[model samples]
Target: MTPDHEVLVIGAGFSGIGAALGLRRAGIDDFVILEERDDVGGSWYANTYPGVAVDISAFSYSFAAEPFASWSRVFPPGEELKAYADHCIDAYALRPHLRFNSRVKRASYSESAHVWTVVLGDGTALTARFVICATGWLTKPKTPAIAGLDTFKGDLVHTAQWDRSLDLDGKRVGVIGTGASAVQIVPEIAERTERLHVYQRTPTWLLPKPDFAVPESVRRLFRRVPATQRTIRLLTDVVTELSFVIAMVHYRRFPFLAKAGEAASKLYLRRQVKGDRTLMRKLTPSYRVGCKRPSLSKGYWRTFTRDHVELVTEPIEEITPSGIRTADGEEQDLDVLILATGFHVLDNLPPFPMRGQGGRDLKEFWKTERFQTYEGTSIKGYPNLWFIVGPYSFTGGSWFGMIDYQVTHALRVIGEARRRRATEAVVRPEKHDRSFRRNLRRMRNTVFLDPSCRGTHSYYLDEHGDAPAVRPASTYEAAWRARHFDLDDYSYER
Candidate 1:
């Protein structure tokens, strides 16, 4: 039999687990969590590539309310991250309400009933009074276009869907893409692989990583005095949050900061890759540091200095059964091809079908009208449907930063709706949605809309080329706005 609930939370990653626990603390128990995976840790569980680790510092990248002072490194590894997710499940007693491997296929709202009918992959249907879509932007893997990909008589791996069983040791491996994943994977793989060919379309700024081990003594002290750990987090958070100002405001508002960043990055490149001017120039970015998300790595540049390693900046024309062919008529053979290509984030499309008012399909609705939302949480036509890390909410803040803001706001909305005996809580259609649309225009003036970003492959822009899929706000500002949000802007239908 289909189940019914007061609220249903989709996704089991950082946002989902955070949301579920937030509900429990709020005295809301009539909720369930549906996770597509059998386990928690959405990206952490799925991405088990050679050197998968968090790019953001572990000190500041954690949940603001829930701190783990025991992380081994400044940035935790993939396995450790998954372990942290497990800890949350246990700490919050979320296992009872957690439904694993229950992928939601579609969801629709009933205007008359004031409820949502959600379907699962296995054809089971359920109903809920409210829905929270926390399926994050980075869930879906994007496959790049290259001819003869299927014909290649070698193992192909997408970084997200990594095949743990397959071994690339002593193999001629060719890594495609130079994003965060490539920086991490290339260093690990190069040590073991016979030869490594890195295919780069455009190079990104590689900053020095300050990754280090957390001493046992520090952990012991943090365990004894929680306030000390919180202080560390506060300092780390302040430094990280300032990057938002540098990227969103200063880079465009003042050219000095941007020029200085470029100069420093060039000096760093020269310092890292000496005696190879061509390779150094190829690796150097022509764009600003945050034009595409700058990657931090201790060994990404040094890996290119290896005798057997080759950085191919030539345009790839097609793939052959035995090797990949470049547009310049050059060919490179490999035993394994790894795609460091990122997720399909800029599409702004839902993973499943979502229909709201008058049975209007969410995709069609977005297609026919402007993609609008109030404070990046609630939509006009979609009542009682909330999004975490949704459009304009990408503060480049810690995942916890966005998670905390949205979850806190959602709780307030839900608490008020239940207290007022309201069946539906929806954002006002015309005025509020229009205001956000105007704000989006202001974002176009930021660094993301710069000419350097225009041609680069980025997740920041949508298909229509709208810059900054996220709201260009600092973490502090986003949290403040969420805390001070007026429920009066939302309509409650009894």
Candidate 2:
């Protein structure tokens, strides 16, 4: 039973608490971390549903090593971002190097003891001369395979595994896939369901959450005004980088900002579903406003202007025993189906089990095509292995500024693996496979990789249409290229 550490960190969230506070400010206190779940708010402790907030903005989604300044709101739910990741694990004492429920399953990578063994899930093995996965990319939960979904039988849950003791008051729910956790659980189960339905397949581009609240004298003037909340998070990161350069280099002079965001989403869908024009053209979304990931809500359009909601864009075609069967043959009974269908962000490291170098297998190098790494945290053959918010590292803005720019390029690759007395480091396989195929062919010429754009298959591409998992820059140029860490793009191993 010999298990130690110098870094192991699997997933205490927020990129394993910024890779254990960047290896405890790089002094490297024999790390640990783990956390299958028992705390430390990873994915805000498995998403406790019901309008689980945070659409970025809590002083640019915190952590420059804790500067929340008491954010009451401006998009801050999920139990106040799981009490601000439990106040950054008690202001960085980090619970004696966490461990929580401990899961890990399988990690492997020895190449003659450069180390990383791992194991866990009751077998317990551990050993780490570096491993920092920070397992995120929306902590699992994808559900949806449909077809009698376990014989309907009612209560099915999924918005990232949320199931808070069931009971949606009058029940009758159903709510499947509208994305962004079904636009925050279909306006919070259309206010205690009794008839919700809400199916829909495509259609999202929401926007207009201008959220509020933060007063306690603006959280004591953003903690006694020191660069006043980093100059209002750098002027909301320069107006969200000039609105992603007006949706990628001035899309035809912003056709009146996409016709005023589609006439304010058709005037908030005719003030929330009055006379339901076929559920307002099935929540109209033919796509455009930044292609996808655009939801923000003032009660998700007044919970589809409830009268016990309805929405249903059809096309389910299964799940019988008493609900959800629409491929036109309609059915809809329900008692509670939920799903909200999201996570599995292009399979970013599902259930551990990596196995890099020669044995290859990062799920067969992402099914031999899509998932690349390079800047999304080094991969070529995964050496000391980092991956804070890995794989193209999604960023429309503020994923805590891309997990503090991948914890400052994984604390400068653990200070270049303690100045070259390194055990392993990799990431130089032809300069990380030609910088991940030149950033997936420069984001396949933008417009959300326009396959003639109409949108829907979320997780931003990877059934081999190849977008290689997000990050088309502009989050302050990916936190200024993850704050400078580029030993000529890696390759060490002494």
* lDDT of candidate 2 over 1-494, digit per residue (tens): 12378778898988788778777777788888999889887888888887788876677677755778877877778888888888877877989989889888878777777777888899988888778788887877778887779887878778788778888998788878887777877776676777887877887767667888877897898888857888887787666655543454344544466557668777876776675677677778776666665767776766776677877776888988778879889797888888878777666464677786666668677777557788887787768878777778766666777777877887787787778777777778787788777776667555666553544676766676766556666666667877764675787767
lDDT of 1 by residue, 33-101 (tens): 999998999899899998999988887877867788789999879999999889888988889998998
For all candidates in order, the CA lDDT equals: 0.83, 0.75
- Which candidate ranks first by lDDT, i.e. highest? 1
Per-model TM-score, in order, reads 0.97, 0.33
For residue 445, what is the lDDT in candidate 2?
A: 51
Position 484, candidate 2: lDDT: 64
Off by over 4 Å in 1: 1-3
